[model samples]
Target: MPPGVVSMAEALANVNPDALHSTQTGYVLPEPALFVTSTLQRQRMFLHHWKLLADGFLYMLGQEPQLLRPQDWRAVLEGKMSGYGRTAGLQELIRPALALCDIQTIQGLPVPVDALPQFSLRATQEIIWEVADTSFRFEFCALDKRASGKQWVAAGWAAMALDERHRYVLRTAALMLDWTTHCTRSNTIHRVADRCPWPPSEMQALETAVCEYYTTAFYEYFGRAAVIPMRLDHDAEMEDMEDGEI
Candidate 1:
């Protein structure tokens, strides 16, 4: 394997945490930021690896990695065992997962909204607020009723792609982990709060508070920014890359 595929711990040890935190929108992140950055770097590395493995694995597996069939399990296992596979044409797969990730990386998120068994209308509204809270508008959008959900789906992926700032936050946070104690079992919410910039110990509580705060402020900001009377349209003008509109 090439050196770039090395474990994240080995790849980004010398990265400057202070630089990453400062480089962001003037937020003084805690030490945990390093681990976040490392995680993101690893994801990018894996994404590249996925693309690289596409061809050989597709030929061997007899299908594209992104569209594996039930019978394709054997090939998947074989590829893993052999350390070869690819992720070509995986942007469709990548966008949804990465969008959730970008949000978690920047905002110090909890459970993914998509992972929920179902979404309340209010919950969906809240999610949009959180997405906009970071002002990374392109990361979240709704499907227009006229487009029959197509526009929203496309917009959703586009939003994730256009979110450059969110990506930077993810890369930065990956570096702050001790790698040993960042998990929920190791550190409680209060512990994180006491030691880190944002605190209160329970991870769930932190997630909840952050979500509530962002959601509230996000709607308020949107209300203030609105020029004309408009209903809350989640997925509007998502079909094309409308600059400065997001």
Candidate 2:
């Protein structure tokens, strides 16, 4: 574990699992559903899922400099790749997030003139329009949707805002998972928390928000079972019951 990263167990010690459950449980499960019968097991499954997402996000942070300082919004909008994005796993992790942004382009590039903000003025904190040598003016904005009862807040240039939003969502999800797992290492969890862009309080709030969002999403995708695998002991119990019946 790196310095400052809190292990998943330590972080999850403070999380309330009941707060992570969803009311809706009628949706169809995705193919190859994860199956867990207990809240603790479900929490573990969630943590494992989040770890995969965190690995993908960290890979992008290290491999794609353009994601942090993108000069060409068009390329990013088109799902352009440089390093880890070329890999199969990372690509699967990132593509859906990138698809959320609405990019308007003409002739394979963004329009030269400034367009309306993708979000409402009330939803934005700051806006920037930079004129490039190509006579194109690039628009970027810092958004604060929290004022309107939304959970996300992020700052970046152009399409990068979408990336920031998705990154925030993933990080918050990871934090929530960390709070739910008891087996995580302390140093590892501390280190993970240390890398977060937001302060501890903010991250906590974001974790609550993201957890709520994902809980609903998980239920919708996996139904009430959430598709986590049953524990070996549970299987043993089932076997015992069958033997007695026979």
Candidate 3:
């Protein structure tokens, strides 16, 4: 394999926790963040490996690394993994899993949330409050609908080109991870405080939190401002991107 793939493969091989325990639900990985700076890098690598890298980061957050197939996220997050519970009962994702970690505290969060091309400060702020909120009064039925009026869709890349989607999600995930690192396994995703679940499932939510750690790796290589930003309208713009509107 070429050096880039070799190094990335090696890095993925190195993404394990400090220790293991039957008593533990998940662990905080201590490795630095590993953000990918260019769309070329992603285009070169195999998608499954990229996904494993994604899952590995999720595992670092004490979440179900199986983002597409979340099984024990709620039980683990809610502290019910030790006993029998329903995996499909509350199929929503929250944030902050644990183990050894290369932490990026929320204190140094960048001023420009518009760095990631497809993301908006408004959307980021909305989810931050949504995930942080602990009240049933504002409870959402699904992760996709958790944000405002289904207007600011988190997965707004549905119609974007594959390459564009990869670039957008990667950077957006990184920026979010950087800002929310302070809340890892230490926040209010508690059982009684409130019940906030991500639509589709908790996998997307957990996936967002987990990306924080891996995005650090990108910063180590390319500073934090690498992911370019752009303003977009969900219905009008994203659809246009698919039709080569941009």
Model 1 agreement with the true structure over 92-202: per-residue lDDT tens digits: 332333343332221222224342233234333333333233222221221111213233322221222223423322222322122222112222323442444432234
lDDT of 1: 0.26
Winning candidate number (lDDT): 2
On residues 1-246, what C-alpha lDDT tens digit does candidate 3 reach at each position?
111112223433443332211122221221111212244233222121222233434443342332222234323322232223463332233223211222222222221333212323333222222222211111111122321224332342222343464444333333332232222321322221243323334433433433333323333322221121122223332432323111
Candidate 2 versus the native: TM-score?
Answer: 0.18
Q: Tell me model 2's lDDT, rounded to 2 decimals.
A: 0.29
RMSD to true structure for each model, in Å? 21.5, 22.6, 20.9
Model 2 residue 70 lDDT score? 24
Task: Name the runs in model 2 displaced over 4 angstroms.
Answer: 1-196, 225-246
In model 3, state the lDDT of residue 147.
19
Please give the ranking of all candidate structures by TM-score, highest first, separated by commas. 2, 3, 1
Model 1 residue runs over 4 Å out of place are: 1-193, 197-201, 224-246
Tens digits of per-residue lDDT for model 2, 1-246: 011112222332344445444342221111122211144333233223322233333333333322221222222322333343333343443553333322122122222223212322211111111111001101001012221234433322112233354465445444333232222223433444556455555544453454343333333322232221111212222432322121
